[model samples]
Target: MSNLLSGETSPYLLQHAGQPVHWFPWGPAALERARRDDRPILLSIGYSACHWCHVMAHESFDDEATAALMNRLFVNIKVDREERPDLDQIYQTAHQLLTRQGGGWPLTVFLAPDGTPFHSGTYYPPEARHGRPAWRDLLESVAAAWQSQRGAIDQQGEAVRQALARTTPQATASEPAAVLAALGGPLQAVAGAWLAQRHDREHGGFGGAPKFPHATDLAWLLERGVAEGDGDARDIALLTLTRMAQGGLQDQLGGGFFRYSVDERWQIPHFEKMLSDNGLLLGLYAEATALTGDPLHGRAVEDGAGWLMREMQAPEGGYLSSLDADVEGREGRHYVWTSEEVRAALTPLEWDLASAHWDLIAAPNFEARHWHLGVVRPTAQLAATFDQPQAAIDEIITTVRAKLLARREQRLPPGRDDKVLTSWNALAITGMVRAAGLAGRPDWLQSARRAADFIHDHLWIEHQGRHRLLATWKDGQARFDAYLDDHAFLIEAMLALLQADFRLEDLRFAQALADELLDGFEDTAQGGFFFTRHDHERLIHRTKTGRDQALPSGNASAAWALQRLGHLVSEPRYLRAAERTLLLFAAEVAHQPGAWSRLLQAAVEQQCPPALIVLRGPQAREWRDALLQRCLPHTLVLAPPDATTGLPAPLDHPLPAAGGTTAWVCSGTQCLPPVHRLDELLAGLAPAPAPPTGR
Candidate 1:
């Protein structure tokens, strides 16, 4: 018989439905049962894509004997970390404090009846091994302690509650001028230098093994490099992107990036492809391409976007959450290949080029039997060795990849989590919009629009006579109160979409999302947004953070979108919320600026507000696309078509100059006179030449 999780919509929870363990999905019923039975709650938190989660499930949850012991000792609760990040966040912090180590998936925490955690761990084996206690032994000990050592457990639980409460940063109030002063004086340069200190010069990403694509950090460095003429920062960002593109972390045969690399050299990845990671990386690579005009970055953007459209997008328009790491109980099975398989799939000429280009002739890279492809030899080098022209070599590489991808498709693929998350899809929309602008792909822009519309039509609703958003949608049902990220990211996505292809409805949708962000999630007193809405179910702790994690911070993204929207529509309310957020987090940011890259971006805008340009007329979009061909990270350009009507203030410029496109440019509150000629407008928007240095 299936457990309580069988009724849940989350793919992760449903995956555990058939386990022998009596699992209760996180809810009031589970907590009540724990309290009634006087039992500790064994909260198991993980996502569907986590490989270790699968391993632990097979080892213990599927074992009938283990399940019986767990049922007798505790009220076993299973939580999809992605679905309940609030619970995960609180417990993960408690785990860190209790264990004095970083936490990972399959988080095992023993919580008191009232929901305070006193002990925690991650991924225990059924049998004692690797210096870890066996699952059965651990459960028995904890049960015995609950009965005999009640006093000690209660004391520790109270202490943990205190620590979890302290995790929220205290608001540091300051005037706007003081906040700007705190951010002044080459802040990006300082942060870039700090980040550069940790850079792995040889491997091309920060630090060592288990490297993730820190897309936010790299984007900031690239912005500094291009906008401030910081060559060192620029080089660091470019080299990392180039290396990641050529590494096994990126799927060379198919497209899209894996979750992260397991090794420092990026030779092998965990193999799960996440929408959040790929979305952010897509926009990053597009910006990189715009900065250097390199075909390498362009190709990365194309392939990555292709993967999103082909594999992740739902027929209804929203993108799915993730592709699982394991297929048929074997990790990396679908992605790795033997040299014999490759040779058989290709002709002599194709095999010769592919072998050298992908290092197929090298020793087995995966478990001593197969290879995960990486670009060990460049196409130019392959051309020189093969005595073929560069174009011919490129064609051969393309043909070989197509053939391999087709063969790989014949294999059973990874399981997909088909739930549509609002925040992740918003990130994807923004990425797709930015990429479409750079690559001049109208189809991509349409894809973004479809997603935006999907969110609007389904996830967005009028509740209690007020506009609000739903966090996740699955099986034609939208559930859960939307968090700060959903509203903020959708606002940012709408803004990006408007810039790429202006629509009055999109602008209004963005405005509504911004308002909802302020109304539902903003901490009016603390001056930052909370991860959960104000009316969300009370948890032990409410997360108000600015640090960028796997995804960008909701607070930071809120500030960014609000500030830009405020400037565009001339609204001081939105602007003040953003300024207040910066002032609140200014001190923590000062101490560890590298950790808060997205917030620093908002701070940068606060110090030097982005230039806002409005184009009006039939050819407005044409002019907008022209200006966007190059990277202009600091400019917010909107081109409302001539037939568009009912635009809000500041956007409602006078009729086009003599039926031709007209541009209205402004910096902060000051506006430059309108320019009718495209050439003249371009000249006006161009950055002034730097003042000559003293000899």
Candidate 2:
């Protein structure tokens, strides 16, 4: 019989409700049933968008024999990792604690009747290969182990539970300065080490096969370098961004980025684009383009934003979650094309321009007729080959891409995961708002606001000052206690909206929600926050910390939002939380800097933390124009300074003031002399002062 998860709204859960494994969804019902029946729970965790997840389901979960074995031997449980990331986090941590290794999706964790983990691993193939155990064998062996070592297994479970209980604050630095002071050298060392190992002379990204576009960290180091006038950092960041723009991982046809590169030089991608990746990368590229004015980088943002609007849009106008990798059981099949295909698709001159611009050679990055990627030709070379100015070729290519994209729409497209997850959607909204800033597209901002309205109106269920967050969507079913990520990212979206237009309700709601998060999920003793809230029923063990993983940890992202909120509103407690979360995870961030870009953003949140650096009075709009002319990336700029910018009173120096012409560079509560000239304002916003010591 199916359990409570069967009645849930999550597409992932609904997909499994009919499984023969007698499945239970991760909840009190499943936990209670398992405990009452004295059956170990075979917990399988994955998401709908995951390709391998579908593979495992087809290979094992769908197989009657495998399902029979699972049902007969244990209380089988299926979990949508996106829905219960908190549950995913707890078990993922336990899997690490037990194995001294890490964990990921299609995660197989054997739990005792009471929900404590006994063993855990991920993605067991139907048949053993490459030194990993097969699913059938693994199930049999685990079952045998459980039966034979019941007493020992219980003892071991107890020990793991004890180990988890001991996951208290190890050593968190007290202040933001102290945390940064601690992180600076270590993060620099890590960046230097990664950069040294890079094939940098190639002017591309780091590492080889199965390459991910983790440009955030690299960009951070570069931003820091630019901020500090360090040539290497800017060089590293700029080169990487430019090269990535030209690479195959960038969708040359449709104008978005795939998940990652499959080979070296980023020539070919695994061919699944995500909203979060494109959104985050677009923000990076826009900032870089603003600084360098490389039209190609600008092209990247334009194309990517175009893709977001055209492809990912929901019927209600918010972004859909993701596009599947497989269309006909073939990965990268739909996106790839050949030289002949391109020639047929375009006019004579257009074909030649495309070929020259793309460096079409015999061995494209694909296997069959229409698969693989080509390196990009520099614009100058394209201009020479096409016998036209570079601008003309660019326009042609852009026009051709649009036509082809429209034509390609006639073909079967990748399946879109339609579940509108709150947390993931929040990230999408963040991207939309950020995209709006770069592209001046009100549609993107409107998209963000609509989603915010959807979440606030639909997803929220109030119970006597308490709130619950749900994970999935159809017509209208967003129920479940929203996790740390949902709260954190939505809070971020609220903040962004407030900044875009100084709305009181936005600030008030964001603040109220942030307080709710702090109350529920704050790891008071530990520096970082927990994934699950206090009201959440305790799992096998509570997971308070986070790994950077594929996405930024909710904890880290929340810390970032808090710091940004603190800067925007001139609050100190938010800064305190930000510092705490960082210190709590300092050990991990110190070791794996790549995973913690949001943490880095949080650190840099203070780097130029908005301390009343308001350009006001008669010289203000001119000062605003000046600030926009320069690249003060990471600073909050109010074009027509509004009331959200709480500038301090009593200007000391005689400054020009025609209401909006004055630019006030206030440090905390103290306003600096108003500066009409651009050069003078530059010196004022160089770096922000530390938050007052005691608060």
Tell me, by lDDT, which candidate is best.
Answer: 1
Candidate 2 lDDT score at position 201: 48
Q: What local distance difference test score does each model get?
A: 0.87, 0.70
Candidate number with greatest TM-score:
1
- lDDT string for model 1 (279-376, tens) is 99999999887766666677789999999999999999999999999998899999999999999999998998999998989898998589999989
lDDT of residue 642 for candidate 1: 71
Weakest ten-residue segment in model 1 by summed lDDT: 686-695
For candidate 2, write residues 115-189 as lDDT tens digits: 889999888889999888999999899989988999999999999989988874465445657667666445755
